[model samples]
Target: MITCKDFLSELNEYLDEDCRDEVRKELEEHLDECPNCWVICNTTQKTIEIYRGMDPIPIPVGVHDRLLDALRMKSQIAPPA
Candidate 1:
C-alpha cells in the first residue's frame, strides 16, 4: 500500500509521467484512499496548469552571459575534486 509521504515524494515525477507503471499504480491507489494527499495533488495540478497557461517572458539581455561568468568564477573558487 502507498502512503501519503510516498505520494508526495513521487508527485513531481508522477505528474511528469516519468514514474514506472507499478509506482504510478501505487500512487493512484494512495490518492484514492487519502483525502489530504488527494487535495495536495489537486492543488499541485492546478498550480502547474496555471503556470503553464501564463505567457513566458524572454530572458533579459546579457543575463545568460552574466550567469555563465558568475558560474565560472564560482567553479574556480571551489576546492578541487
Candidate 2:
C-alpha cells in the first residue's frame, strides 16, 4: 500500500501522466483506498478540467507587477537553498 506522503510526492507527475506504469498503478490503488487523498485528487482533476476548457484570462499589469513584487520580497526574506 502507498502512503499519503508517497501520493503527494508524485502527484504532479501522476496528474501529468508522466509517471511509470508501476508507479501509476500504486497511486491509483492508493486513491481507491484513501478517502482524503481521493477527495483531493478528484477536486484537483475537476479543477484542471474546468481550467482546460476555458480560455486563459491575462493578468492585469498592475496586479501582475504587485504579485511579482510580493514574490521578490518573499524570496529576499527566505534563506538561500
Candidate 3:
C-alpha cells in the first residue's frame, strides 16, 4: 500500500503521466482508499485543466514580485541569488 507521503512524492510525475505502470496502479489504489488525497488529486487535475484552456495573462511586475516574495516567506525559503 502506498502511503500519503509516497503519493505526494510521486504526484507530479503521476500527473505528468511519467510514472511506471506499477507505480500508477499503486497511486490509483491509494486514491481510491484515501478521500483526502482523492480530493486533492481531483482538485489539482481540474485546476490544471481549467488553466490549460485559458489564455496566458502577464502579471504586472510589482504584483509578480510581491507574489514571489509572499510565496518565499510562506515557505520560509531564501530568495535565489
Candidate 4:
C-alpha cells in the first residue's frame, strides 16, 4: 500500500499521466483508499483544468519580481548572481 508521502512524491507525474503502468495502478489504489489524497488530487486536477481553459494573463513586472522574491525567501534560495 502506498503512503501519503508516496502519493505526494508522484503526484505531478500521476497527474501528467507520465508514470509507469505499475506506479499508476498503485497511485489509483491509494486514491481509492485515502479520501484526503483523493480530495487533494481532485482539487488539483480541477485547478489545472480551470487554469488551462483561461487565457494567459501577464503579471505586472513589480508583482512578478515581488512574487519571485517571496518564493526565494521562503525556500531559502539565493537570488541569481
Please name the candidate that would achieve the greatest lDDT relative to the true structure: 4
Q: Model 4 Cα displacement at 51 (Å)? A: 0.9
> Candidates' TM-scores?
0.63, 0.62, 0.63, 0.64
- For candidate 3, the clash count comes to 0
Off by over 4 Å in 3: 56-81
Candidate 4 or 2, higher TM-score: 4
Expressed as tens digits, the lDDT of each residue in 1-81 for candidate 4 is 999999999988899856788999999999999999999999999999998899977999999999999999899999999
In order, candidate lDDTs are 0.85, 0.87, 0.90, 0.93
Error of model 2, residue 27, in angstroms:
0.3
- What's model 3's overall lDDT? 0.90
Candidate 2 lDDT tens digits, 1-81: 879999988787788856798888999999999999999888988899998899888999999988877987988755345
Worst 10 residues of 4 by lDDT: 11-20
Off by over 4 Å in 1: 56-81
Poorest 10 consecutive residues by lDDT, candidate 1: 72-81
Q: What value does the lDDT take at residue 44 in candidate 1?
A: 95
What is the TM-score (0 to 1) of candidate 1?
0.63
Q: What is candidate 3's CA lDDT for residue 26? A: 92
